[model samples]
Target: MTLHATAVPFKDGASTLFPGGLPARGGVGLKPEHFREIIESKPDIGFFEVHAENYMVDGGPFHHYLGRIRADYPLSIHGVGLSIGGESALDRQHLDRLAALIARYRPQSFSEHLAWSSHGDLFLNDLLPAPYNARTLDLVCGHIDQTQEHLRCRMLLENPATYVEFAASTMAETDFMAEVLRRTGCGLLLDVNNVYVSCINRGRDPNAWLDACFASIPLSSIAEIHLAGFAQDYDSSGASLLIDSHGSPVARAVWELYRRAIGRTGPLATLLERDNDIPPFQALLAEVSMAEKIMYADAPRALSGEVCA
Candidate 1:
């Protein structure tokens, strides 16, 4: 089932239209609530990323407005249902639909999680963690190979925030992800909030984790950055737990971490993700503005290491 990497040229007019990829500025998650406003006002932003599963179906208003938005701004397709790490083979049907979507939109970039969301034909509807071991690594790499071959585009794999760690795991998360990137020729979509969440939940320092990641996977391999908010909760042992709820504005601490990340990655296409407790589009733009300011303004490299209030 291996497909060799060969160029699948973009549709004739697509190349002339979208001559460049997403800018290294900031963007927000594209929601139905903001479609009309976006179509009418045409907000100034770097790009827009949409969940591929949301637009998998054949047409209606979603495609109509998305087509208009796609024309004006670069689009990034982020998938939540690929189940790349699952033990089962990559779902051929889902891959076909994803490939069709890519052909239709010609997004500037595409990405999926490092975790699995399906077992058998049943989808769990959540991105669940996988062990950082030899077997899981092989499975994930194979899936990425399938996805890239079918879609004819490089895809970024995002790190996951987990509530529990697998005792059977034999490698650090960063090292595992680095290996995956090496084997698949894919890129990383460094999610600073996920770093903060996984570290805080597992009793580790977020800054140290970020540094470790940079040491293993060169910043150049990171194609995009994701900044989001988390909900705070507690475990039975009263240990602090952070949930990747994406239900609020990016936290102050996560913002500091993002500054550090971009200092190394240097203005990659950054996305602000808010899936629940969705606020007004204007409020989301304010956060995007903050990200743009950090990305575009000249700053010292040392500033990245320092997390200021």
Candidate 2:
């Protein structure tokens, strides 16, 4: 299940992508709109996250700016194209391209969604939910194991923001993730925003999900936390679902949930994800500054040797 070919110690501060360490603070998703602004302004943020797929294609303005920005900031390559939970095997060509990029970029960290993006070779840009059955779990494990081997880096699997639950699901989402990490020794990229969004959409309790994540999953395996916004969708039956489109800023409630999660995993690398309706880099960095304030807010209280009330 070891994905890394090089002898990378799983010890603290191992990956250069994570070199400055998991920020008790966070940064915004690196968008093209903000590229020049980010470089010129040089905002004081922990790091920047980029979709590996966006940069996968060659000879474009994206890489041109990405390279320059990367020189100044630690980068996280978060991918949604791997389709880890799909019925078929991992896309070998995609993995090869992804691995090549990872090698060239030397990213601080690499992550992918636990949900599937492809089914039987048909690629879907959206993260499709998988039924939590043994077959799906096995597929995820095998793919994750193979990805780690192919990329020669320990990958962090992210929780998906799901809308509908499959009737065939036999296990809780947290249990499925625990099994995958247990089988593969890969890390978890907990998405608090996705948890809130999914809970709202699926009628599941967000607190319960967090408890399951904290208790059943390996805290040591937690490499990062993600925060993003969701849009609501209504079904024919009048039921509503919150979709993780990442088109807006993190909600206030989601930020509160983030506080609780950080309480569990102190200073985990957190990112403010905005995939659509991209904004100016400085504006996004302002949000990052807000997160930084919240993340370190309790430090002064804790350092006084007083229990955080």
Candidate with the greatest lDDT versus the true structure: 1
lDDT of 1 by residue, 200-269 (tens): 9889999998988888886657879999999999999898989999999999999999988877777678
* Alpha-carbon lDDT, every model: 0.86, 0.80
The global Cα lDDT (0 to 1) of model 2 is 0.80
What does candidate 1 score on TM?
A: 0.91
List the candidate 1 regions with Cα displacement exceeding 4 Å.
Answer: 1-19, 298-309
**How many clashing pairs in candidate 2?**
7
Q: Give the per-residue Cα lDDT of candidate 1 at 265.
A: 72
Off by over 4 Å in 2: 1-22, 299-309
TM-score list, all predictions: 0.91, 0.89
User: Alpha carbon lDDT of residue 159, candidate 1?
Assistant: 96
Supply candidate 2's per-residue lDDT for 187.
85
